[model samples]
Target: MTTKNVRPKFLNLFRIHLPVTGVVSFAHRVSGAVLVLSLPVVVFLFALSLHSEQGFERVSEILQCGWVRLLSLLVLWALFSHLFSGVRFLLLDLDIGMRLAAARASAWLVLALAALVLIALLMGVLL
Candidate 1:
């Protein structure tokens, strides 16, 4: 008797998985959009605080909260990831990282760079 073949149950198991570069590329665009939308509100608050000393002090106080600091660091991470990934994309467009290993290595590098930027920002080393 012949037996019928069964397909894999996992949706992704039979599919070719996207490499890390693909993931980073997709994340870069998403992060960039988040940054773009946030820019307006951030600048508005920034400008408002600059209008007077009291406004400045008020904004400063708001920024002093731990939650606010954490949010700012998260924003910084998104911005950093977008910036680094954009550069990676540009390099890829220039025919760089064409090999599988190179692409994976570059993706890891971008993640590392983003982490470094976030750490530095948290340490108050970069604004």
Candidate 2:
């Protein structure tokens, strides 16, 4: 008699748990993608703003909308997340924080720092 296969044929992503480091690494990749994708739009907006007084005012008006401000905040958060996580990754490459505990702590620190930067930016913008 042969034993039956017990392996799952499909993955349930929602049921899978990742460590803090894993989450931070994944966020790093996602944030990088977001920043890359947003670059063209940012360049276009910049060029438009420089075209003339009308163009500058139009860009300003578009940026002043509540939804646009929220989106800008998200992009800003992505930028910080990518920057902090990148530095963490570079430190990891240098064998700093190679231990499991240190790695985990660094991962948490990266996340916390990025969030703190976002919060500070929001406060500065709103106040």
Candidate 3:
């Protein structure tokens, strides 16, 4: 086969381990994408809840479901992840945390901050 036409028969993603910073960067993009895609649904739900009393009750009832609450928690994580990572990127843009160690540390901090937010939210709803 010509080199140009050749492709690996098996691409092994699991075999290659990403660094913590790399994983954080990947998650940042993923969370942003999730936020963009979920925005429309959130807006629709908000509009529905505000349109009428019956609509508000229906929306509240749906939110009371366990699975919906779980999903909402996931969405909350995505939001916090996106927010924290975005701020991290902004700092990088301004020449902050440009060192390898600082970058890695900040990545961990961002992930930790997102997790904290998720935990706080879950506790609020569960307790």
Candidate 4:
């Protein structure tokens, strides 16, 4: 069987717009993945810091590097986003905001709260 006109499998998927709820759901999974993948590195750093005073100083020095600082910011974002989105999903599961309009609004509110919290945490870390 030969097809003359071929449509790419993901073409329509890429072209279509995702609703707010979908966006929130996507972000939630991405943030959770980042956190899960980062656990090993985080644990290593924590253990190194606890090894001795010198180890703690080394950990602090490593964190002071520009790339490490940026990575820390990303971790903060992942943590906050995961937390906020989890709460949203829990509420949805309970049928608290099951309506289409309420679901959309809650999705946006979670995103906004996560951004604000991330900014605050970054300021604390940087300053």
- Where does model 1 exceed 4 Å of error? 1-18, 125-127
Candidate with the larger lDDT of 1 and 3 = 3
TM-score against native, each model: 0.78, 0.93, 0.90, 0.88
Report lDDT (CA) for all predictions. 0.85, 0.95, 0.91, 0.91
Model 3, C-alpha of 29: deviation from truth (Å) = 0.9
Show where candidate 3 strays beyond 4 Å. Answer: 1-10
Count of clashing pairs, candidate 2:
0
- How many residue pairs clash per model? 0, 0, 0, 0
Winner by lDDT: 2
lDDT (Cα, tens digit) per residue for candidate 1, span 53-125: 9989988998888887777777788899998988988999999997889989999999899999888776774
Off by over 4 Å in 2: 1-6
Per-residue lDDT value at 42 in model 1: 89
Tens digit of lDDT per residue, candidate 2, span 1-21?
999999999999999999999
* lDDT: the better of candidates 2 and 3: 2
Error (Å) of candidate 4 at residue 96 is 0.6
C-alpha lDDT (0 to 100) for residue 62 of candidate 4: 98
